[model samples]
Target: MQLKNKKVLVTGAEGFIGSHLVERLVELGAEVTAFTLYNSFNSWGWLDTLDEKYKKHMEVFTGDARDENSVRKAVEDKDIVFHLAALIAIPYSYYAPASYVDTNVKGTLNVLQACRDFMIEKMIHTSTSEVYGTAKYVPIDEEHPLQGQSPYSASKIAADMMAESYYRSFKTPVAIMRPFNTYGPRQSARAVIPTIISQILSGAKEIQLGSLLPTRDFNYVKDTVEGFIQVAENDKTIGTIMNIGTGKEISIGHLTEKIIGLIGRDVKISCQEERLRPEKSEVNRLCACNKKVSEITNWKPKYTLDEGLKETIDWIEKNIHYFKSDIYNV
Candidate 1:
């Protein structure tokens, strides 16, 4: 399907992946509506960081996703929807599991319901590798058994099932686009990439981190964004779940060493207790099965881990002031 001149709605347009997605949609000449979580400051989150020209092209809709009226209004008259809004921090999810349920599960219900009602052409529902938990097997595929090791993953699992149900029960056009460990500029401190980058950017001699043994399949944010668009553009992906990832795994310990090398840091690594997840909750390893996505859509990761990390480091170096390196984010 062609994307140019189409009207698209991107929920979570103020977030790291969402913001880049909005910019990409704009570049592709799509008429974009940006759905951002409303705040007292009237801030648009990372979308506020975008240049005026690109930001001007977006119709910013400030609303809570859990509110059906707000979400329904945003869905009205949109040809396609990219549902990316969620409460994504796993540690924070442990504190407020109900919030994750309300936003991730209930909010996704709203999106699916709206699409069913309006018969939207495409709905790309975002999923995460976390739902697979610790990989029981290498290259976890779409058929891999989902293990909700945390509240965040549980909520996402609920959301994903909701999307699938709509397709099976009501024939809603939906694509489950699961991304594995996306990292890039504008990412929040709650994520490992930014946490390490922030500390290095702050010139800390001691780098605090959690369990460094967990492994992940990392995808560059730009590649992640492109994968989303490509999935949406293909009719063959409807009612299917696909993973976006580079089929490569890196341990956190090794990742930290790489970061230290890239940042030229001689810092001593310190394992902070608060930074660690429960052993049962930690995903010990994850390497994605990207064959499903490649078979249906022209989606592929375009950056090597080192290349992506270098770009992320450069961004953090310049935006060091935006981070609170003195405290643990979550």
Candidate 2:
């Protein structure tokens, strides 16, 4: 289970959390292969921003996760596989549910089949809190019933079920890592934290947002990546689903005010109709019970909400040019 010198392949390595995980794995002396979506620009996504020292430790593979041949090639000879590739935007999923099923569901099936054929040491499949929809109970546990309120959530629910079935039917060494609202420096502007930070940094007097009443348990990206590594390293986590979160919740309205205070700005909140999810699709509350992960692995959130928000604000302030704060990012 020791990662040092282990051959690790991370799907979606170009993404926010995946990039951080790749960097951390390299720092731990793991032989890393970064599998990113193929682009004519040959872009590595967020991984392109990594310094040369870290990049040198990584082998970049450009391919689509939806392609079984590409996924199989990437999984071959890897000691462990971290499956993170997916179409994650909620709004976009609404626009193209079929694409979500193709990328999220079928893409995951590609990885599972590859792992099964190659007999990889382990596979860490990514899951989202969105699959739980609006919480029916406070501090939702792993056993809480999943309610797919949106196409995005439904796609993820299908993907998670596929991973679970692989573990049960084929005895695949797959562990599902479900993270709740992870946000940090490299996160896309589609996410609320980045949306708020970019607007405030862009000197906007009014911040446009969706429903402010919905609550979420946010975890820092670094903490979430740590959970991925810890869950993979622990044999007890095999064939299990672990929730990585802070066991805390905050309303979007309050969260926006907190971010405004951190940015040292006074901004009016404007609820944009286009920004809002459909009434039933909107998840009203989410709070994770980290008991499973805490008991199974020595993992806990290392950053407080305020501390994480401040760090995100600092990063966005420096990288303000990357964001188009005037436009609502779908």
Candidate 3:
């Protein structure tokens, strides 16, 4: 299960976490293929920002993951496949639930089928903390009941189940990696961390946010990527779902204040109705129990919340031009 000299295909390799994983895989000496959403402009999303040295060890394949043919082509001849491609924005999912199903669920089906056909060694399917919805208990474990409160969470639930079924029915080597709130460089402004950092960096005296009460277990991008690799390299992880997180929780309001302190700014918080999720759809709290991943792999979060936020703030400050801080990014 060693990754060295192995062939790995990462769907959504152009994304924040995916790009970082690709860089890590290259560093591990794995032959990497980056499956990005197709675009006329040939943009590789955040992958374009990777150093050319890392890009030399990787192949970029532009294709829609929902397309079975495209997915098959990308999965072909690969030893392992990490399925990360999906429509992940929760707010956008409310506006277009059908698109979320098509991209998240069906896109995952395409990957699963291709893996079954190709007989891939391992398939690391990405899941989210959103599927757990509001925690019924503190420090939620893998045994926690799943409650899909949003269209995005529902779609991901479907995708995770589909991956599990593949492992059971077809004996596909699949490991579901559910990461709790990962944040770092190249993360979209739609995510809370980026939203807060971008706004503060943009010199906003007032920060617009939704619910401040909801608590989340945030993991740094590098740690999450390592979790993915560790899960994939461990044969014991097959047919199991593992949670990757810091196992610490933070309320959005408190998290905002921390970011403001890091930026050394005095800002007032404004509750924006448009940014709020529907009452039932909002997940009130999430805290991860990393017992499964810790037992299965040599993976644990290295960066503390303050440490990660500092890195994110530094990156956002230098890349403020990429964000429209005044607008609420859906």
Candidate 4:
């Protein structure tokens, strides 16, 4: 269970959480392989910006997760595999549901099959709170009904089910790690936190957003990554699904005000029609019941919302040029 010198492959290593996980794995002395989406620019996404010292401990693989051959090659000889690759933008999913099915469902099936064939010691498949849709009750647990209100959430539900099937039929050592509204530096502008921060940093006095009443359990990226490591290291987590969250909820409107206050900005928030989801498609509320993870492993969110937002704002302030605040990202 010790990660030191253990070979770990993280699919979607170019992404926000994946890049942070890759960096943490290297720091833990794990032999890391970063699986990134192939691009002509040979871009490693966020990995391209990692400190030079950490790069020595990492291997970068450029390939599509939808390709079985590539996933098989990446899974080979790995002690653990963290599957995080998927099309995660909710608005974009409405435009191209088929792409979500292909990348999220099909891509996850490829990863699970590869792990099963390779007999990898462990596989951590990523899940999201969006799969639960609008929570029917406060502090939604693992047993909550999954209502796919968006194509993105539906694709994730299918992927999660696929992982479960692999465990039942093929005995793949797979565990699902469902995180609730993860945010931090390196996150895409499609996410609300980044969208708000990018706009504020761009000197926008009026912030455009969707529904402001929807509540969410927001966890910092570092806490979510630690949850992955905790789940992978714990043998009891096999064939299990664990929620990684802070057990707290905040409305989007309040969250926006919090961010604005942190940034010391006077901003007016407006609901944008272009950013709103369909009536039934919108998840109005979500709050995680992280009891399973807390009891099964030593994982808990370490950052408060204020602390995390401060860090995110600081990072975005310095990297303002990377964001096109004037253009709606989705």
The C-alpha RMSD of each candidate to the native structure, in angstroms, is 0.7, 0.6, 0.7, 0.7
Candidate 4 residues lying further than 4 Å off, grouped into runs, are: none
Cα TM-score of candidate 4: 0.99
Clashes of 1: 0
Taking the tens digit of each residue's C-alpha lDDT, what string does model 2 give over 1-330?
Answer: 899999999999999999999999999899999999999999999998999999988999999999999999999999999999999999988899999999999999999999999999999999999999999998999999999999999999999999999999999999999999999998989999999999988989999999999999999999999998899889999999999999999999999999988878888999999999999999999999999999999898999999999899888888898899999898
Cα-based lDDT at residue 161, candidate 3: 94
Ranking by lDDT: 2, 3, 4, 1
Q: Estimate every model's Cα lDDT from 0 to 1.
A: 0.93, 0.95, 0.94, 0.93
**For each candidate, how many residue pairs have backbone atoms clashing (under 3 Å)?**
0, 0, 0, 0
- What TM-score goes with each of the models? 0.99, 0.99, 0.99, 0.99
True-vs-predicted CA distance for residue 237, candidate 3, Å: 0.3
Q: Pick the candidate with the highest lDDT.
A: 2
lDDT by residue (1-330, candidate 3, tens digit) is: 899999999999999999999999999999999999998999999999899999898999999998999999999999999999999999999999999999999999999999999999999999999999999997999999999999999999999999999999999999999999999999989999999999888888899999999999999999999999899999999999999988899999999999888889898998999999999999999999999899889688999988999999988888889999999999
Model 1 Cα lDDT, one tens digit per residue, 259-300: 999888788888999999988898899999999888888677
Residue pairs with colliding backbones in model 2 are none
Please list all clashing residue pairs in model 1, or write none if there are none: none
**Cα-based lDDT at residue 122, candidate 2:** 95
Model 4 Cα lDDT, one tens digit per residue, 6-70: 99999999999999999889988999999999989988999999999989889999999989899
